[model samples]
Target: MFNIYKEMWDRRKMIHALSLQEIKKEYAGTVLGSVWGLVNPLMRIAVYWFVFSIGTRADNPVGGAPYAAWLAIGMVAWFLLNDAFRLSQKAFRSKRSIIKNTPFPIAILPAVQITFSFYTHLILLVVILIAMAFALQTVSVYWLQILYYDFAALMLLLGLGSVTAPLVAISKDFGRFLDTVLIFLFWMTPILWPVENAGPLENVVKLNPFHYIVQGYRDSIFYHSGFWEHPLYTLYFWALVLVLFILGNYLYKRMKPIFLDIM
Candidate 1:
């Protein structure tokens, strides 16, 4: 695990360059170019705000903040995670040319995709902060917890991408399966809806790692709670992350030698 991360650190410059290339390539043909990255998420937020807050007449303030504000915080976090999952799964295949020809560190391929998603994530975060300044009217020191949560999210992505990237490379079927799983996870997570009155189900929902991230974002913004406050939940989250890191590295090492053949 350390070696995988060490390689990623050593090749950090390449990762940054490739991630930038990915962002440019994604918007090359569009007239708006990289502006679309900010535009796309803002548009989604606007549509969701209209549908949930205005259309459905569910505009009640949540936790003393506007529903739109609350939704934006959660959705922003989810967007990063969803994009990272989707892109990182195909990182190896997307850069197959480099992998096939050069002696590149295949492990960093997932990092490249995650880094790309993070660029957009940072932009969306700034938008959210600006929106919060107007909507909430007061800033709390707890907002700094975003840094911790961002680090947590990155670690989770790296761990998950490591495991799934190889699987997707091995079988395109896994990529399709992952899409279905992502949709299911999106609904199961408390992004679109809140989990207020559930009895035992709330505990089950908390078991979802994505829930930890989504809720962490909310906690940072609306709840004004530190991650350390939820000691057991934080412990559970890190324990799961550790497991994933171990499993991901194991899979990467076992599969690295055969990736060229399979691809």
Candidate 2:
């Protein structure tokens, strides 16, 4: 396992290069190009804000922050997570030409996808910070704690991607199945709804690994709460993420040699 990670680290430059190429190719020929990274998240926040805060009359502010600010915090993270989830599954298929032609490490493919998502996440984070500063009247040091959740999220995505990307390449139906499940996950994960108002379902929703990430974002940006404050959640999240990493690595290794056979 250590050797596997060591190999990936040694290819960091290649990963970075592929990630950038992926981003450029994705937005190639578009007028705004990468600027859409900033625009896409803002558009998503606008629609959700209008629907929930205006249409449904769900105007309760989270942690004293305006509904828009609170929603932005979670939406930025969700957008990143959602992008990683969907793209990672297509990592192998999307890179079919490159995979067949290049001798690069296969593991870096998912890393490239996740890095691309992280780049967009960084832009969205900046937009959200500006919104929070305007709406909340104050920003706290605790906001930096988002790095913890971001790291956790990256690990989870890479782990799951390692497993699913290979499987999706083997059978396209798996991709379709994953797409259906993500729609359910989107609603269940509390991005559009406030956990405080989930009533008896609050505990159940908290069980979702993503809930910790979404809640962590709110805690860092709005609640001013440190991660250490929630000892059990921190422990639980790391444990779950660690298990996923192990499972993902194991499955990825088993599938790696067979991937080209199917592709």
All candidates' TM-scores?
0.96, 0.95
> Residues 55-108, candidate 2, lDDT per residue (tens digit)?
999878665777777788888888888899899888888888878998857777
**Could you tell me how far off, in angstroms, the CA of residue 22 lies in candidate 2 after the best superposition?**
1.3
lDDT per residue as tens, model 1, 132-210: 9887888989899999999999999998998898888888899899999999998889887776645679998889999
Candidate 1 residue 210 C-alpha distance from true site, Å:
0.9
Candidate 2: the clashing residue pairs are: none
In model 1, how many backbone clashes occur? Answer: 0
The 10-residue segment of model 2 with minimum total lDDT is 1-10
The per-residue C-alpha lDDT of model 2 at residue 217 equals: 89
